[model samples]
Target: MNNTETPSFEEWVHYCFTQGYSDFHTEPDADHYEAHEQRRQRFVDIDPKALSEHIIRLFSNPAFLADEYTDQQIADAVWFIFGLATTYFLHLRSEVVPRNVQIRCIESVATLYTDLFDRLCDKHDVDPNKSSSKDTPLEDAVYMIWDMDCIEGAVMFPKHWPHLVDPGFRVLETILEKCRTVTCKESALHALGHIHMYHPERVEKIIDKFLASPDQPGVLREYALDAREGAVQ
Candidate 1:
C-alpha cells in the first residue's frame, strides 16, 4: 500500500471494498488499534486536508451523475466515505490532529453527508412535499442519521467548536421533523439528547414540541422523554 498514492475512482472503490473494509474491523486492543491508527495516519500525517479532499472528489465525479455506475458501486463508495468519516471522528476525539485540520475534516464529513443525501433523494425521486411517501430507502435515512451522529459526537467533546453547533442542530432538527424512518428519527432524538447536554435551553422547545405531538412515534416519544430528563439532570 503506497501511502502517498492517490487512487483513481475504480481503484478507490476496490481498495475500500477489500482492504478498507478489513481495516474498519480492527479490534480496539493496543496493537491492533495502533496498526489501524498508523494506516489512517498515512493519509493525514503530512496533509491532513488531502484525505478528505480525495474522498469528496471521488464522490463528486461525473460518473455518479451518469447511469454507468451500478447501485452496488455507489453504495460501496458511500460505505468507503462513511468509514473514512468515522476515522476522521476518531482523529478529532483523540485530539491528535491539529484543530484547524479537525475543523476542515468536520466540514468535509458534513458536506459529504449532505451531498449523499441530496443525490440519494434525486435518485429515488423523493419529494420533500410529500411526507407520506415511503419511496425512500431506510438505508438512505440511516446514512444521514449517521452523519448527524458524527456531528453530535464532535460537539460533545470538551473543547467546543462554535462553527458546527448550529449546523448540527439544523441537521438533527430536519431529520426529526421530516424523516419517515423510525430508526433514523430515534437516532436523531438520541443525538439531540447528547446535544442537549451542552445547550439545554436551545433544545428545550424542540423536545417539548416533539413530546406534544400525538402523531409522533412511540420510540421517538420515549427518546424525547429521555432527552428532557437528561436536560434537567
Candidate 2:
C-alpha cells in the first residue's frame, strides 16, 4: 500500500488475474503468461472498476514490483497496467489522462526498464547500439508508445507486422506519431528498424510535406508500402 513497501511478484500477478483477462491485448509470450499463472488468480469474476482502482494503486507505489523481476517482467507489467488503465478509464472511457499522471506512470517504470536494458547490455558486455538483439517487449509495447493522453497505443512495430520495421521508415513515422522525443524518433526512423517495412517513397513524401509542415506531422511517399529500386526516387 505504501511506496516503500513493494508487492511480491506473486501479489502483482494475482492482482491482475483477479481483474480479468486484458480486454484489448494480444497473447503475452507463453513463458510470461505461465509465470503469472503461478501466482494467485486475480479475477475470475469481479468488479472491473474496483479491480482497476486496485491495479492503479498497486503499481502507483514505487515498491510495487518483486525484487527478482527482469526486463520481461517489467515490460509485461507495463503492458498490463496500460491495458487495464485504458480499458477501464481512458480510450473508450475517457480520452484524457493528465500529464502529471502520465509522467508519474512512466517514471515509475523507467528504473526497471533502464535496469533491464542495463543488465542485458552488461551480460553481453556491449553497448545497446552494438548489441545484435533488436527487440524487447518494452520497445514495442511500452516505452515507444507510452504517452500522457494515451493518444495512441504503443508505437513500435508489431512482430507480426515485420514490414513495419522496414528501413526504419514507417517505424520512424510510427515513432514521430506516437512517441515524444524528436531525437529518438529520428534515430528510430533512420537506423533502428532496417528489416522490413522500409519505404523510401513515403519518406520523400513525408519530407516534402514537412518541408513546410504545420504541426500534426505528415507521412512520406513510399511509407507503409514498398518503395524500392526505381521506385525509391
Number of the top-ranking candidate, with TM-score as the measure: 1
lDDT of 2 by residue, 1-233 (tens): 33223345455455543332343244557767754443223332223444344543554453434454555555555555555443432321222443344333333333333333323322433232332223455344443333322312222333422322232244344444543332233323333223223344555465444334344222322222222222221
Residues 21-110, candidate 1: write the lDDT tens digits: 456555658757866776555533324345555544544443443254444544444444444534544445344555555555554543
TM per model?
A: 0.55, 0.33
In model 1, the worst 10-residue window by lDDT is 126-135
Question: Candidate 1, overall lDDT?
Answer: 0.52
Q: Which residues of candidate 2, in runs, are more than 4 Å off? A: 1-66, 83-122, 131-233
Which parts of model 1 have CA positions greater than 4 angstroms off? Answer: 1-3, 8-10, 26-46, 54-86, 90-151, 157-159, 212-214, 231-233
Candidate 2's displacement at residue 222, Å, is: 20
Using lDDT as the measure, the top candidate is 1
**Model 2: number of backbone collisions:** 17
